[model samples]
Target: MAESSGGPKKLLWVMIILVLLSSAGAAAAIYMVLDERDDDNPEAPSEEVVESKPPVFLTIEPFTVNLADDRHGTRLLYAGITLRVEDEATRELLETHMPQVRSRLLTVLSGQEAGQLTSSEGKQQLAAAINERLSEPFDENQPPPELREVLFTEFIVQ
Candidate 1:
């Protein structure tokens, strides 16, 4: 009876040690994996640590022009455009060449049909056209203006 009791006690101690060793090994593996990840990506900035620049916008005055006849006798488009320029230099370039900018906008607006400007796709196409035209350099010697977006604040067709 004494030997049986001792045998069971020794078995229990062995089991407890195995469990402790397994737990320690698991903890070490987890620590190693996390440490390796940190070392592998040392330069990755967390979202909270990232910095962003504010947007710059350039607003153009409203335009009223005759749309394509489309056999509708007469049609007109009234649009207010705002340009999202890449930087202050682009905005200044547009402002300095206000006459040329207005001329280009008027030409694009007047060429659109009233029916085509009424839909969402048409409006997007119009915006793209405007962006393309505005991106052209005012001076052949200088780089073209960088336009991020062409937004129409107001659109009315009659």
Candidate 2:
């Protein structure tokens, strides 16, 4: 009877020792995984060492254009125009060709009625067309000037 009780106690002790050893091994593996991650990224990047690019500047000129046709039975036609151009060269090119731009815009807008211009989709289409026309003069090989956006500052039809 005494020997049987001792055998069971030894079995319990063996199980306890195995459980402790397994837990210690799992802890060691976890520590090694964390340490390996630390070694991968030994140094952090310095914020001060980074440099950023300067923002590009854009300018617009307000235009009040007169349409040829009087769709609304009135002679007055007014539109606020803005041009989005990139550098000085492109700006100069647009400035030099102001008469052409005006002519092109007049031709494009003259066909549209007051109701068409009032719609959001109409305005977006018009802007896209205008952008396309404006970029026509630039060489196809080189990147065209980035037209930021077209805004209708003031639109009046009479």
Highest lDDT: which candidate? 1
- List the candidates' TM-scores in order: 0.72, 0.51
Give the count of colliding residue pairs in each prediction. 0, 0
Candidate 2 ranges beyond 4 A from true positions: 1-76, 138-146
Candidate 2 lands at a TM-score of 0.51
Residue-wise C-alpha lDDT for candidate 1, range 1-158, written one tens digit per residue: 34556887899999999999999999999999998998799597766855665777999999999888997878989899999999898889889999999999999999999999999999999999999998898988989999999999999999
Question: Lowest summed-lDDT stretch of 10 residues in model 1?
Answer: 44-53
> lDDT of each prediction vs. the true structure?
0.92, 0.66
lDDT of 2 by residue, 1-158 (tens): 34566887899999999999999999999999998987788585545766754433333444454444444653444677676566566667666667776777677666665655668887888788777766676545655556556566767765
